[model samples]
Target: MKNAMPRTLDRLLASFLQCGTWAACALIGAGLFVGTKVLTAGVALFILLPVLRVVLMLAVFARRRDYLYVTIAATVLAVIAAGCVIGIRLGPLAG
Candidate 1:
């Protein structure tokens, strides 16, 4: 367990780039939900990314039952949520 944080952090950092992957998936899902507009798609994606991340994180934690991993994953999800909120608020105006 002592090495879990470092291992988790490393895994997270590697997949941090995959945030874009989640974002893209989200945008596509959102577009499907709200109709196919660039702004709406962007907004949908912004919201979806964090949700997907949270769901995936929860699943991973559930499977492993690692408290440290869960905490780190939750932190990442929170950061994603903050970014999504800011982006959603600004997205329409930017359009």
Candidate 2:
């Protein structure tokens, strides 16, 4: 009974994981925003695209279990890299 579950530890782990996830997302978003072909498009894509990708990947993670955390982490990193390669441009979003 004593080892049934460690509520405090569970809470701590959850917090750490969530914080890490959010930070990863924010960094990727910022990088993507800065590096897009169009500044305005980049900003919009940075904010929205990752959110969508994360949501979709969440289900995949749930099924795979082991890959969830790693996938999320890798995704954040990919977004950052993608941002850098996107470049810059001008159009309707600039207004």
Question: TM-scores for all candidates?
Answer: 0.41, 0.33
Which residues of candidate 1, in runs, are more than 4 Å off? 1-54, 92-95
**What is the model-wide C-alpha lDDT for candidate 2?**
0.55
What value does the lDDT take at residue 19 in candidate 1? 75
The parts of candidate 2 lying over 4 Å away from their true place are: 1-5, 35-95
Candidate 2: C-alpha RMSD after superposition: 11.0
The prediction achieving the highest lDDT against the true structure is: 1
Model 1, span 1-95: residue lDDT tens:
74785588458745853875666667767678767795476665655655765667666676677777778878887787798799999999999
lDDT of 2 by residue, 31-81 (tens): 676654344444554466555555545554455464756577567767766
lDDT of 1 at 46: 58
**TM-score quality measure for candidate 2:** 0.33
| Poorest stretch of ten by lDDT in candidate 2 | 1-10
Q: What TM value does model 1 have?
A: 0.41
Top candidate by TM-score? 1
Model 1 RMSD vs true structure: 7.1
